[model samples]
Every structure is written in structure tokens, then in C-alpha cells.
Target chain A: MPDDNNPIPHWQRQDLPPMLSRRFEFETYSETRRFLDGVAELAEAAQHYPNLSFGKTYVSVTLDADGKKVGPDLVALAQQIDSLVAGTP
Target chain B: MPDDNNPIPHWQRQDLPPMLSRRFEFETYSETRRFLDGVAELAEAAQHYPNLSFGKTYVSVTLDADGKKVGPDLVALAQQIDSLVAGTP
Candidate 1:
């Protein structure tokens, strides 16, 4: 069941791999690069790094669970990542 | 036929999408981040951006062809990327 009030609704949850992932699209490579840089800084500050893949206009981010289940910390991290482009134009 | 003297022998050529791709592994996330920055600089300088995907210790890069085949320019770009880690400890 999907939560209607999920803070990071765009992110998909995986069970077998115990991961949460999302793909963000941008209007240009510059925007994509900016988002990536923001994620890097956030990861550095939180000490929680995620797998990131990007092309000219999109970035795919995967957050792995340290334990068997996706915990609150991971969810909070995802919310922070979502905030990177939350109100951007 | 494989070119024994190919400058970017590590990069694999794909026909369907007309792309040249390669994966580079690093000893640490810091090294991976450095290589990624170098690639970004090279792409900006050459105006030829490649698809980049990375985790904590590896980066996968893909260069797409503008036409039917991977051209010399793409090969040159791959060579430059390879140089970013060549002969380094």
C-alpha cells in the first residue's frame, strides 16, 4: 500500500535489495549538475551516501538500507533529497 | 575485430545505441568523486557530455554517437577520461 501522505512519494521502495530509489529529470544539464552537487553535499553532511547515475538531463539516486528495513533515517534523507528541487523552476 | 592498439581499449562499443561505454573502479569514494569532477571539466571543455553513473567506488561512463557510429571525437573524449586515472596510485 502506498501512503498518501508520504513525504517522498516519488521514491520507489524495494524489498529484495532493501533500497529506495528515484529518478529526477531536469530541463538542462546545468540543472542536473546542480542537483547532483546538492546531493553530494547533503551526503557529506549526513554521512549517508547514495548511488547516483546521471545523463544529460536526468539523475537516478538509490539509497540503500543499512539494516533489513528502510528506516526513518533513510526516509528523512530521501525527504531532504526531494527538497533539493522541491520549489525550483 | 578488436583493435589491439586502441587507445581506449577498455571502452566497449555498442552498435544498437551507437555508444561507447566503460566502467572505472576506484579505491575510495574520494577518488571516484575526483574522477567525476575531472570528467565534468573535460565535458565542459569539449562540449561533449557523457552519461555518468557512480556509487561509492566506481563510475560508469557512456558516450553516445551523433550519427550511425561512434566517431573519433568520442574516442578522443574517452581517452581523455582514461587519462584522468592513468598511472595514478
Candidate 2:
């Protein structure tokens, strides 16, 4: 069942890979770059690095779980990533 | 025949996608981040963005040609990317 109050709404949970993944779209490359930079800083601070793939106007981030299940720390990281673009102009 | 003096030696030429692609490895995430930042700056200056996929210690970059064949400009961009790590400590 889907959680009605999911903290990380944008991310898709994958069981096989045991990861949370999300693709963020932007209108311009500059916007994408800014978002990428924010993610980098967050990763550095959290000491949790995610796999990132991007093109001119999009970034796909994948957070892999250390074990078989998605943990609270990973969820928190996803929430932080979501907040990177939330309420931004 | 492969050119003996290929300027973009690090990149592999792909015909189906008409792209040049390469993978760069790093000992640490910080090194990968620095290379990514350099690529971002180069893309902004050259106005040519490449598809980038990275993990904690490696980045894979792909430059898609506008037409069916890879052009001189794309090759130049690849060379410039090569220089981003050349002779770097």
C-alpha cells in the first residue's frame, strides 16, 4: 500500500535494486546545473553519495540502500534532495 | 581505419547514436565532483552539453552529434574534456 503521507513523494522505491530513484526535469541547463550542485553539497554533508545521470535539462538520481531494505537515512536523504527544488523559483 | 593521431583518443566513437563517449575513473568522490564541475564550466562556455552519468568514483560522458556524423566541434569538446584531467594531481 502507498503511504498517504510519504515524506519522499518524488522518488520511486525499487525493491530489486533496493534503491530510491527520481528524475528531475528543468527548463534550462543552468537550472539543472544548480540542482546538481545542490545535490553535491547535500551528499558531501550527509556522507551519502548517489548515482546521478543528467543531460541538458534533466537529472536522474539514484540512492542505493546498503542492505536489502530501504532505511530511514536513505528516506531522509531523498527528502533533502526533494527539498533542493521545493519552493524554488 | 582508425586514425593513428586521433585528437580525442579517450573517447570512443559510436555510429548508431552518432556520439562520442568516455568514462573517467577517480579514486575518490571529491575528485569525481571536481571533474564534473570542470565539465559543467566547460559546457557553459562552449554551449555544448553532454550526457553525464556518474557514481561515487566514476563519470561517463557522452557527446551526441547533431547530424549523422561526429563533427570537428564535438571532437574539440572531447579534447577539452580530456584536458580537464590531463596533468592534474
Q: What shift in Å separates residue A30 of candidate 1 from its native position after superposition? A: 1.4
Alpha-carbon DockQ of candidate 1: 0.82
- CAPRI band for model 2: high
Q: After superposition on all CA atoms, what RMSD does each candidate show versus the true structure?
A: 2.1, 2.3
Candidate 1 stretches with Cα past 4 Å from truth are none
**Model 2 reaches what TM-score against the true structure?**
0.91
- The 10 consecutive residues of candidate 1 chain B with the worst lDDT sum are B64-73
Please list all clashing residue pairs in model 2, or write none if there are none.
Answer: none
Q: Compared with the true structure, what per-residue lDDT tens digits does model 1 show for residues A30-52?
A: 99889999999888887888999
Q: Which stretches in model 2 have alpha-carbon errors above 4 Å?
A: B1-3
The candidate that achieves the highest DockQ relative to the unseen native structure? 2
Interface alpha-carbon RMSD, every candidate: 0.9, 0.6
What lDDT does model 1 reach? 0.89
Task: Count steric clashes of candidate 1.
Answer: 0
Query: CA lDDT, every prediction?
Result: 0.89, 0.91
- Tens digits of per-residue lDDT, candidate 1, B1-89, equal 87988888888989988999998999987998899999999998989878888988899999989656888888999999989998953
